[model samples]
Target: MTPDTLNFIIIDDSKLDCFIADKIIRNTGKAGDIKSFTNAATALEHIKETPPPADAKTTVLLDIQMPVMNGFEFIEAFEQLPAEIVGGYNVYMLSSSINENDLNRVKNYHSIKQFLNKPLTSSALAAILEEQAQ
Candidate 1:
């Protein structure tokens, strides 16, 4: 499915980042329902509470740097969820830092689709959505 019909969740500590990402996702006209959470912990909790359906097309853009739970920590927790609960969603780690360690760490997780640099762009989102369609 295209991004226009995909649900998007923006989990970032920065309010501005969330706002910008939200706008970018909206501009795609393929986004179904967009949700944002400044707190990673809250976002994780919400994920636990509301798992996507097996056929649901959803994507989560999670920030790697946060106060309590970073993206890695969130993934660690998210991994504990049932396959049916987390399997249907694509999770992308979003970060401004280009640290090699962070990039390598993402390789360890099968759930993470890819690492996206800060300031989500329409073209990037479009490409990701197209890839998912394949």
Candidate 2:
């Protein structure tokens, strides 16, 4: 898929954070469809039930500090999906927590592109987009 046609899925427990990210992503005019879920499990279900088009590239912004299903847990579940379905997605873990363990744990997941700090900014999004462009 072309970079300009990239879609997004944001999974964060905080509604405000999700709203902020949705607005920031929209302002860049780089996203196609942006869907946000306060629950990681529900987001996972959506991905499993309704996969994106084969040519579409979808980026997942997952928050690490959630109640029911945390980012790590989500990653575990996400990895179980079929390779073709998982191939269309790029997961980036987002968290406000500075716990050394949390930061270190992200490295273990091959599917996780990077770990980003909370409150997704335009610059960070731009960098991510630029990376995807290549």
* Cα TM-score per model: 0.94, 0.96
Q: After superposition, how far is residue 134 of candidate 1 from its true place, in Å?
A: 1.7
* TM-score attained by model 1: 0.94
How many clashes in candidate 2?
A: 0
Query: lDDT of each prediction vs. the true structure?
Result: 0.88, 0.92
Query: 78-126 in candidate 2: lDDT tens per residue?
Result: 9999998888899999999899999999999999999999778999999
Q: Candidate 2, residue 102: CA error in Å?
A: 0.3
Return the clash pairs for model 2, or none: none
Residue pairs with colliding backbones in model 1 are 3-30, 4-30, 4-31, 5-30
Worst 10 residues of 2 by lDDT: 1-10
Residue 36 C-alpha lDDT in model 2: 98
Backbone atom clashes (below 3 Å) for every candidate: 4, 0
Off by over 4 Å in 2: 1-3
RMSD for all candidates, in order, please.
1.5, 1.1
